[model samples]
Target: MLVSLAIATANQPPNIVFVLADDLGYNDVSYHGSEIQTPNLDKLAIEGVRLENYYVQQVCSPTRSQLLSGRYQIHTGLQHSYIGVAQPNCLPTEIPILPQWLKNVGYATHMVGKWHLGFYKKACLPQNRGFDSFFGYHSGSEDYYTHFRGGYGVSFDDRDHWLGYDFWDNDVPFWSAISNYSVFVFNDRVNQVIDKHNKSKPLFLYLPFQSVHSPLQVPKQYQEPYKNITNNNRRIYAGMTSCMDEAIGNVVEKLKTADLWNNTVFVFSTDNGGQILEGGNNWPLRGWKASYWEGGLRGVGFVHSDLLPSDVRGTINKQLIHVSDWLPTLVNGVAGYPLNYTNLDGFNMWDIINSNKTSPRKELLHNIDPWPYQPKDFNTNMTSAIRVGDWKLLTGTPGANNGQWIAPPGSGITPHLPLTIPGQNVWLFNITADPYEEMELSEKYPTVVKTLLAKLDTYYKDSVPVRYPDDSDQANPALHNGTWAPWE
Candidate 1:
C-alpha cells in the first residue's frame, strides 16, 4: 500500500531520471575525494542525499542484472559476462523488467543510452521490455568516433554490417550519425527525449552513459585541459570524466529550464567499480573492478527526488543498500507497481531515504563465478562472498581477485593441467579501520573465521550457481554447489 500525505496537490506521480556511468569509481567524483570538477553532481549531493555505503556486484552484467531484475546475478542465470549473443542471453524475457512495471502505472518510460543486457530480436528490444522510447547501442562498448565496433580504433566492421542495423528507437530503425563525439551525441539525444515529453505526464528517463570506459579516446579539447596531470593513462581518463561531468551539468540545466527539477527524481550511479589499471584510480581502497574488496564493488550513489523530506533534503546516508533495492524503491515511490514477486535480494530504503535512519540488512551479499574461465585452487579465484559488519571474507585473495578466476589455457577439460601461482592468501579485514586489505587479521581470530566460513557455506548451499561446478567448485563444494535449487 502507498503512504498518503495530507497535502493533496495533484495525483501526478513524480518523474524519475536514472543516470548511470560506466567505470566511475567511488571516490573519483569531485564530491567524494577526487580533484575532478563536477559541480552539478556536487550540487545534487548538497541538495539531496548521498549514499556512501551502497554496494553492487563485481562486474557489469551482475550489477545490471540486479538493477533490472531486483535479484542477484546467479538467480537469473547471468553469473558471468554474457559475451556472445546466445541462449539464456542477456536478461531473461520471462522475468519482468523495471520499465515494464513503470509503464503499467501509466508513466512514460524512455531510455537514451546503453542496453547491453539482451536483444535477441525485435521482441526482445527496449520497446517490448517496457520502455516506450530508446536510442543507443545494443551491444557493449563502441568506438566514440565511428560507433562502429570496438572500444578503440579496432573495428569489427569486416564481420558485421554497421550501417545496415545501426541505431534503434522504440523497436524501429532510428537515424545513425557516426561522429568523433559519441558522448555528446548521447547526451543531446537524452535532452531531446526530455524536451519532447516534458509537457506530458510523469516521465522516466534511463540514461546509461559510456564515457569513462575503455578505448582511451577523448576529444582533443577535453583532453588538453588535463595535460598537467602528468600520467598519460590518467590524463586521457580525466578528460573523459570531466566531459561526462559537463554532460551531466547540461542535463540538469535542461531539467531546471523546464521547471522539472523539484518535481523529478534524479539518480546518479555507476555500473561497477573503477578500472584502476586502465585509467581509473580507486585510491585508499585495495582492489579494482573485479575484486571482492571494498574498492571492487563500491560505487557512488546520489538520489535527488521531490518526495524527500524537508529535513533530509540535503543529507547523507551511510546505510548499506544494494543495486537490487532501486527497483522496489522506484516502484514504491514513483511507479506504484505491484510487488507480488519474491526472491528480490534488496530491501526498500524508502523510510531510510526519507529519515536518514538505520537500515535492516544485517549483512550485504557479494558473489561471482569461480575460475572466471580457468580453474584454480582455493576457489577464491571463483565464487560468491559475504560482507558482515565491516569484515569481508572471500575464498581467495581480495587484491588478486579480479572477479574472475584464471587457469592455464585448455586446462578445464583435462585434470592433469599444471597449477598457476597463488596470488594472495585467504583472510579477513576490518574495513572500517583499514579500508584497504593491506592488514590481515585472519590468524589472530580463528573463531571469527570459522563462523564467517560457516555462514558463507550456508549461503552457497542455498544459492543456485549460475554456472557448472568445475575444479574450483569441486575444491569448495557447499550445499547447493552446482545445484539448481532456489532459496527456501
Candidate 2:
C-alpha cells in the first residue's frame, strides 16, 4: 500500500500555462533577432527549451482547432479557412477537445483571450466546448477599444454595418471597457484566475493574447520605447509587441508570487506566421500569413518547467512539432503515461523534449486544399504539401491569390523582395538544405519526389472532405446578407 501511494504521488501533474500570441512574426520577438524588445519572451527562451521548427496551419481557425483536438484541421471540418463573424459553422460537437481531456484527470481548465474557431451559436462558444471559463472575443479581429467587428459589405450608417461588441466574460457580455490596454486587461484577468483557483486541483490556463494583430493600438508608454524606429507602422507594431511582453512579465511575476512558478509547465507560441500587411515581419523566411511557404507555417515557440530535464533547459530543440502535438504532449506529460489516443495526427513529444533528442515525428502532412473557400468565380484547385525527413513537396500554388503587401504604410518595404516565383504546379525542396527554398530539385530527384507524392496522396485520401462555411446556404440571413446580429 505504501509503494502504491508513492507511485500515485509521483504521478501527480504540474500546473500548465499556455500563452499563444496572435499573428506574431518569426523574427518579431527579440530573441529571434528582431529589433523589437521582448525581454520577457527572451527570458522565457533563455530559461526554457526553444522549439526551432514548430509548424501550424497557414491560417488561424484551422490551427486553433488542431491545437485543441490533437487532430488535423482537415479531419475536423476546419479545412483551410476561418469562421467568419456570425457564420453558422464551427468545430463539430462530436470531437473531444483538450480541456475536456485535462478535466477528466482532475485539472481545472480555463481559457482567456481570442476564440476564433466559432461563435455563431452558444454551442460553438468556448464555455460549451469544454473550457470551464472563457474571457475574450470570438471573431477573427475586432477593434481593440470599441470591441466591435466592423461589418462586411455595408456602410457605417447601415444597421448591419457593425457587429455588436464582442468582449465576453464566460457567456456574459463584457460591456464596460477598462481604461487599460486590452493586453493589460487580459493579463489582469489571468492573474485573478491564477490567484483564485483552488489549490487542490492542478490548473490549465490557456491565454491566447490578441496582441500585435490588426488595428495597431498601444498605450503611449509602450510606444515611448520604440521612438528610434523611423517607420510609423513598425514603431506601433513594436510597441504592441512590447506591451504584450510586459503583460507576460507581470503574469509570470504573479505566478511567482503565488508560489506556482517553478511547479508550472509553461508554453509560449504563436498561432501562425505574421501578417505582413499588419507590420509583421518574417525576415529570412519566404512568405507571410496565408502562404504555405516556410514563413507562413513556421512559428516561434518555447516550453519551460521544473519538470523539464535540467540538461535540456535553455537549449534549442530542432524538433518538427505541429500545433496538434500540444494536446497529446501536455496530456501525456501531466498524466505521466502515454495516452496513445486513436486517430490523432499528433505525436506525444514529451520524451523527445525531456531527453533533448530528435523528435520521433519523422514525417508531417503539413496542409491540404488550403484555399477551398475561394469564391465560385475564382479558380481554385487542390493545394497541398507534405514534409518527409528534410524533403518537402508542394502541389499547386499555395498563395497565388494572396495579395502582394509586405509591410504597412510608412515601412518603406517592397512586397516579396528578391522575388522568385515557383512554377505553377509541383515544387520540391530539401527544406533542411534550403531553408529559404532558394533551390528546386524536383526534376533532379524524381524518385524522392515520387515517394513524397505517394505519401501526400495517402494523406489526401485519409483526410475528410473540405467544407466551405462561407458557401453554406444555411447561413443565418444576417450573415448571408452581410449584417451583424449577435442575437441571431
Candidate 3:
C-alpha cells in the first residue's frame, strides 16, 4: 500500500528515528503534570500524535527485545528480567530482527545508546545485529558520566565489585570517547551519523538513551533549575530529564539542518514505566516498574511526522498499541512491505498513527513468567498479565510495590483507588474504565477472568522457556582486562 506510505521528499521510504527513554514515568513529564521540564518531548506529543494508551514491557530488555524482534517476549524466551552484563543469555540471534528487516529494504540501520539485549558474544552486539554502525554501551545500567558499568568483582560473587568503562565505537572498545556526560557523547554521535549519512537512502536510527535510568547523575547546571525540589532523587532526575529534552531538541534541529526533517518520522517511547524509588512517579496508576499495574506497563509515547494528515495531527490517540507491533508497523506499513511473508505479534500501526483509524490490537499477553506448578493459575500460566478487550487479568506474585499507588513526595495527592484486594495474586481490571486500576474486579467478572486465563495458558503453550541465565565470572571486568566485553 504505497498510497498509505508517506510521499516523503525524494520519493524514498521515510527516515524512521525511534528514541527510547529508560525507565521514564507516565507522569514524570511536565506535560503530564510532573515538574520535569521536557519541551522537546512535549512538543512532539503536542504537535504530533500523543499516544495516551501505549503499552510496553515492565522492564528494559523485554521491551527492547519485543520492539526489535517484533514478537512477544514468550516467543523469544526473554520473559524474565533484563539481560544483565554477566547473564549468559541474550535475545536469540537466529530470528529475524527489526534492523535486519529494514536493511533488507535498502534502509541504513544504525543504533546508538544502550544495548541491553545481550553481549556475551559478538553476534549479540548491535553492529552484528544488523546495524551499519553502533556507538553505545553493552550493559543495562552504568555511570552516565564515568561510563563504568558495575558488575560482580568475580564472576561468581554476584556483588557490585568490578567497575569498567563501557563505551564502544562498534565491536571494538573505545575508552577515549571524550571525558564528558553520555547525553552529550551520544547526542553528538547521532548528529554525526546524520551529518555523514547518504541522504539518498532511508535511515533507521534506534536511539536508546542512557538518561533517566539510575545512578542519578547530571551536570550541576542542568540540576540548578530544580533548586526548589527537596527530594535528592527527584532533583537529579529532573536534571537528567532536562538534559535529555535538550538533546532531543538539538537532534530535531540537526535533522532540519541536514534537510531530513521533511521526510523523517520520529517516534519516542519509554522502555517501561518509571521506577518510583528512583525519582520517578507514575501517579494515580498503581505500583511502579516491574509490576502489572498500569503505572508499570502504560508508556509515554508519541509520533511526529509531516506524513500525518493535518486534521489528525496534534491529537490524542487512545488506540491500543503495543511495543511488539513496531516490527510489522515499520516493515509492512512505513516501508510498504507486504505482511504475508511474516508472522508478527506487532501490527502495522501506521493507520492508527497516521490515518486515525481504529487499532487492530484488542488482546495482549503481557507476560508468562517461569512457573513449574501451574495447576491453580486459572488453569493457565502463573506470574503473568493479559488483556482481552477491556479486561486485564493479573495473576501470581507481582513482586515489588504490590497494589501500592505511591504518590511522589509533596505531590499532595491522596489516591482513592481502593488498595484492598482478595489476595496478593489474581487481580482483574477493566483498564478501559479504570486506567488507574482503582478497584479489583476478579470476583465481579469471573467469566472474563476465565477466558483471559485460558488465553494466557494457550500463549504459554506456544512460549519457549525463559532464557535468563545467571551471571558468569566471564562477564567480570577483571577477566576482560577491566572491561565488560564479550567472553562467550
lDDT of 3 by residue, 358-414 (tens): 999988888888645434323423689988889899888765556688787677777
Give stretches of model 2 more than 4 Å off: 1-11, 153-160, 178-180, 337-340, 370-381, 400-423, 471-488
lDDT values of the candidates? 0.68, 0.76, 0.84
Each candidate structure's TM-score, on Cα atoms with residue i matched to residue i, is 0.83, 0.89, 0.96
- Candidate 2, poorest ten consecutive residues by summed lDDT: 372-381
Best by TM-score: 3
In terms of lDDT, the best-performing candidate is 3
The alpha-carbon lDDT assigned to residue 62 of candidate 1 equals 75
> Which tens-of-lDDT digit does each residue in 1-488 have in candidate 1?
13432132266667888998888876578887675666778888778898888887766767877887788775776665443322224577778888887877778999887777755445656667888888876655566766645212112333232222334565544446566476888888877887788455778888888778876888878878766676677778878898988898898889888777767778888888788766776655656687777777887888986667789888888888888888888876445566777767777776777787788776876864543553322244455567788887765544434332222122242222212245644567776666655567777877877878777666555555454221121111122231111112
Residue-wise C-alpha lDDT for candidate 2, range 354-406, written one tens digit per residue: 76667879998877774545332212146777889899887777672432334
Which candidate, 1 or 2, has the higher lDDT? 2
Backbone clash count, each prediction separately: 8, 0, 2
Candidate 3 global lDDT: 0.84
Each candidate: RMSD? 9.7, 4.3, 2.0
